[model samples]
Target chain A: MHNPSQSGASLEISDLSKAYGSFKALDAVSLTARQGEFLSLLGPSGSGKTTTLNMIAGFTSPTSGEIRVDGREISTLPPYRRDIGIVFQHYALFPHLTAAQNIAFPLQRRGMPRRDVAVRVAEALEMVKLDGYGDRYPRQLSGGQQQRVAFARAVVFKPKLLLMDEPLGALDKKLREDLQGEIRRIHRSLGITFVFVTHDQEEALALSDRIAVFNHGRIEQIGTSRELYETPATEFVARFIGEANIFSGTLVRGDAGLALDTPVGLLPVETRLPAGRQASLVVRPERLEIGKAPHAGSDPHVPATVRDVVYLGSNRRIEIVFDDGRTGIIRGSGRGTDVGAGERIDIRWSIADGYVVPFSSSQTGDGHGS
Target chain B: MLNDTRLRWLILFVPVAVLGVFFWYGVADSLWKSFASPEIGLQNYAAFLQSPAEMAVLRRTFLVSIGVTAVCLAFGYPYAYLMTVTTARLRTLLMVVVLIPFWTSMMVRTYAWVALLQNNGPLDRVFKSLGIGGLALIGTPGAIMIGITQILMPFMIMSLYANMVRIDRRLLDAADSLGASPAVAFVKVFVPMTVPGVVAGCTLVFVLSLGFYLAPVLLGSPQHAMLSQLIVQQVSQLLDFGRAGAMAGVLLALALSVVALGAVLARPAIERGYGENT
Candidate 1:
């Protein structure tokens, strides 16, 4: 039990934005972190997540809005004065400095006593589990080793907010998983506020206490991983976070509940849209059940043909072409089940599993995998 | 491209033959003359060694060389750093400014400095307004220093810029985010990172300064004569080839020794930094 407020501070970003000429990179994005939460800003490339991180780190000045750490306005402050730590995408360890020296740099710069700097540096190295790697140069280490050194350097001085911009993006899968575990361990022990920016949705879901999904310079939704995955507010959030089979149609009032009349049949949804407006409904691939026609008490059912069956290890991805000439994908564990391409199958999802989203005709029926 | 061993040997033989004919041949003759002098056994070498006037000239040459190297480092390091950090269009403009002296003839640039540092010239007028007009700058060690540094600053700037651009700028960002102020970050992280560039650039400037004759001859007086000029005096005025050869040999040995010592000191750092940056 480390108390974060002793070393970490709360952060509030209110109506913050940045623009390049006529192009807006960030548009009035706001977020907050209570003292020791791991908040991830998740988005695709150029979706303003990295821009927001840069603004918070004071590397790029905002065109408007304010960033406050524990109510101290820091938008006008330079990066060095902000007392934050950032681990870059490529671990920018000073190649000239040995591992221990790299960790000691910040301590020395603060004019900490030489003996204490040495002690703290050793402690930081051990915190990253690199106990005897103090004498090696950066190039002499492997990528994973360098990444650990970077984490140690960033956290050595106990910064209030440790900002990481896709710090694990460059590593291979095995190394990334290993470092993610190490980062989680460090976060648990240090209790520092971590503002991580990444495009990897799974990584965000695995690490974040809260995820702010960004798109086109605006935050689509901000919530926990479960909240964002289970109930996405907008169509972009629904399609961006997980595997979703999205259908677009006219919103129609129905007997049982609200429904959308589309090529995939009228889908009874839990959310109601404005009358007669074009609406979209999202049913996650895992939510759809494939079998015979549903009983009367069961949810809405659709007649579909199996166009393709992709054998994923634990689950088989069955691509369904609906009777109305539209397509959908359903993922389920198909052990001992005989399912092949061109097989006629019946698909249905519970009304509660369907989330009705405000649909723009701009992005119509397409499968999105994040 | 030169994977063929015969072709590689043939290509190397040309430079080796040319070097043997013009360079190594002259150096070998000089070494022979330095030892097998007027008495054929250490007479002229002893005269050259025991002379205080000659030793004083050698000492002053080294001082000027070191002073010029220090001045170049001061100016070139920041300028090269700016080149790396600026935008592309601005970088091109800065590059043109740095290369102006390099492209212009060395004699032409030295003369330009002479005109400026002479009495009532552009620099002299400014100095005169500052009430330092009485200080003679035209034919002194200071003028020669200015001229040499100006001519050699480009070498330092180019060398450092080539290495500085390769420095991962994110390291500076990392340092700043680690709570070091911008100036402190520059000193602790950025300066040490560019050590290889500094070592290479300073060695180039120092060695070039040791053998520089034209700028010193044109900008400095007889009282400020460097070893190159002293050797020229020995041969042209004193008609003493053996003594001048010995002096030239000594100057060559000194320059090589400085380069060797600098490389020895900078080897580990260069090896470490270049491995990552490249």
Candidate 2:
């Protein structure tokens, strides 16, 4: 019988904040996720992603704020009463119990019939593709096997929300990728709300429906992977998410709308910012095009000399020094041109290809804001 | 490789020589004294084993040791668990309480139990005030159990605490997050992980209790005489070296057998218990 309450509860976290004396681990953070959506909290260490997950799992109390599941507030409830499942970084499986017994724990605790518990445990083992590993203790199993057991144990009780905190951190690169696929498959089949936390950008980009980028105890931006990559809200998000070359200059009104006046000459921008204020040009490396002569169009063409070329498998990163003595990098397929060091080149990028971030020029003479 | 082997053998040779001199050498001399003196050929061994009176005392010794073990486990397990869960200051306080008993002399501890359990003593006075003096427990089997448990309780708690500290607390957290209430998680996850400690503590207390002399003398009457009392009497008052040597040999064999049997039973648990095992 399907539970009337099993409606795939949507999660709403509001104004969640945590402080350890003077150091604020988490600021007023709020987010919402539709039921059955896989959302990832992506950030560097000490950026409060784990703290937010901890608060949602009821492991730690928020200094102030509330968490709601389908309009039900569960801020003060104990962990066991909150009906949440959590997978830790270390597997944390019961060392004395076999894989089957470990999965059977929560079901048995809920007073489910003994026969039903056994049936569900076997079902869960099958779900993780560990059907025959029921009798091995944690020490006897491989790291990947233990990881699957931990995942199986968390979901066997049919929790409507699963929070995983860097669950693949301890495994090698190959196994991490392997278990990530398993986790994505399980999330699809379970149809429950999934909130994952990780610092790896590629993992977050590959697995999340929407990624909330965290920085200094705040969520800087939350959106689809392409949105965050193409147009980040701040310089911090641009630098943290992936490789980028940022150019700072004064914003000026131009025929193309707002253009940034830097040492390398005028460059077009797509965003609105106060004229004459110090702003930044956030350009993804792949957006820049290099050739012997710049392509003629509405794009901004600048002159540069190739200083070094690094050969990455599918692409080559052409490190260049502009004529203005400022450095810039252009990533492109190495097949395009046989450009070598000391070659004069021209780089072209359309105004819409990059973003502009304006900061308070009052904060610093150099225009870097806190 | 040859030099390494020679150095390793030299390192092992010291303890082997020490055991040979004090343990095997003493055992061979005692065996000779017991069997050869007062006419050889198993005469004294046969005499001691055939006496029903001495057999009864041996039987009682085992019963008392078992009783003491049970009592220690009942109190020691909770005390050790408390040490694991408490705050730092409270843990220090509990540790002091456990180690204070160990610091006291065994004779003094036995005498303390006697002082409290005797007629119209502090404990009996409380019972008398409650009009239950008819249940006077002094100079009985219960007194010996109480006295021995107090003396041996420290060893049990320390051994248990050592193992409990190594248990990954995150396992309990994982259980709680999986929808187990705190009480259920503790019973199902935490307690099973501490089996090695329980087995080790119980064996230590039981084997050590069999050789107790002071507590049984002070707290128990002659009607409840144990094997240790018989061995002590044979040597101290009767001056029967041959009889005492024979009885000492028997006690040594019993203790060794208990340890050997325990090792055989506990091997699997030691190899595959709570933490990483290879």
Tens-digit lDDT track for model 2 on A188-251? Answer: 7778889999988888988999999887799989998888888887777776677777777888
Model 1 misplacement above 4 A = A4-8, A255-257, A292-298, A302-308, A320-327, A335-337, A361-370, B1-3, B37-44, B86-90, B113-135, B233-241, B274-278
Docking model 1 quality class: medium
Two-chain DockQ for model 1? 0.62
Judged by DockQ cut-offs, the docking class of candidate 2 is medium
All candidates: CA RMSD in angstroms? 3.3, 4.1
Q: Which candidate leads in lDDT? A: 1
Q: List the residue pairs that clash in candidate 1.
A: none
Instruction: Please identify model 2 stretches exceeding 4 Å from their true place.
Output: A1-7, A254-256, A261-266, A291-298, A301-308, A318-329, A335-347, A358-370, B31-46, B104-140, B218-223, B237-242, B273-278
**What lDDT would candidate 1 get against the real structure?**
0.85
Using TM-score as the measure, the top candidate is 1
Q: TM-scores for chain A, candidates in order?
A: 0.94, 0.91
